[model samples]
Target: MIIEGVKLMFVGMTTVLLFLSLMILLIQFVSFLTRDATARELEAIQKERELQSLKRKKKKEASADSDEDIAVIAAAIAAFEAERFART
Candidate 1:
């Protein structure tokens, strides 16, 4: 009786193992079929990220340049006014 029970347990285990293996293979095959689509999606995502980063960098640089230009203009105007007052 014990031997029969052991045999039954092994059979059930083997059947489950085989089913799991088949499922894994099917999943892999599906993934392989969609590989190109997945790669394209990944590439597009990477490109979008790069573009966003570049845009952010440009905005920062433009703001910094504007600040510097404002400071330089203010200094030049102050110097001109000081010279005009001295002449008077």
Candidate 2:
């Protein structure tokens, strides 16, 4: 009967709507449960990046000191060469 078909359609639609709503709720619950852990992971990655940045800054400073030493060595070599020519 047409009336029975209409009733069946509505029932089916309602059932599907309820199922979809339940699925959405379950997904939201899982996301909420894992939120803290995800936040912690992000914080740890941020800390690691900060540490790497600090290490790079220290390496740059050390390299600057070495550059000064290299300059001094070059000057000493130049002076030695000049004295040797003066003596010859």
Candidate 3:
């Protein structure tokens, strides 16, 4: 009975090892087949990120310009009110 148990354990371990090795080999093969496609996809993703960053920078610059415009308008309005009050 002890011998039978040892044999069973050996067979089970060997089977598991073989299955894991085969799975690793299959994954490597698939990756090898798709390597070029994956590289292109990575490049596309990087380009998209760069474009998004540029868009964000442009938006920030535009908002900064608008903030300056708003400040100038506010100053003009304040000057006009002060002049009117002085005349009154």
Quality of model 3 by C-alpha lDDT? 1.00
The weakest ten consecutive residues by lDDT in model 2 span 29-38
Superposed model 1: Cα runs more than 4 Å off: 69-88
Cα displacement (angstroms), candidate 2, residue 59, comes to: 1.3
Which parts of model 2 are misplaced by more than 4 Å? 1-26
- Model 2 accuracy (lDDT, Cα): 1.00
What is the C-alpha lDDT profile of model 3 across 1-88, one tens digit per residue? Answer: 9999999999999999999999999999999999999999999999999999999999999999999999999999999999999999
Q: Evaluate model 1: give its lDDT.
A: 1.00
Among all candidates shown, the one with the greatest TM-score: 3
Better of 2 and 3 by TM-score: 3
Residue-by-residue lDDT tens digits, candidate 1, 4-67: 9999999999999999999999999999999999999999999999999999999999999999
What is candidate 3's CA lDDT for residue 1? 100
Q: Give TM per candidate.
A: 0.68, 0.67, 0.94
Q: Per-residue lDDT tens digits of candidate 2, residues 1-88?
A: 9999999999999999999999999999999999999999999999999999999999999999999999999999999999999999
> How high is the lDDT of residue 31 in model 1?
100
Give Cα distance to truth, residue 20, candidate 2, Å. Answer: 7.2
Error in Å for residue 36 of model 2: 1.7
Overlapping backbone residue pairs in candidate 2 total 0
The local distance difference test score of each candidate is 1.00, 1.00, 1.00
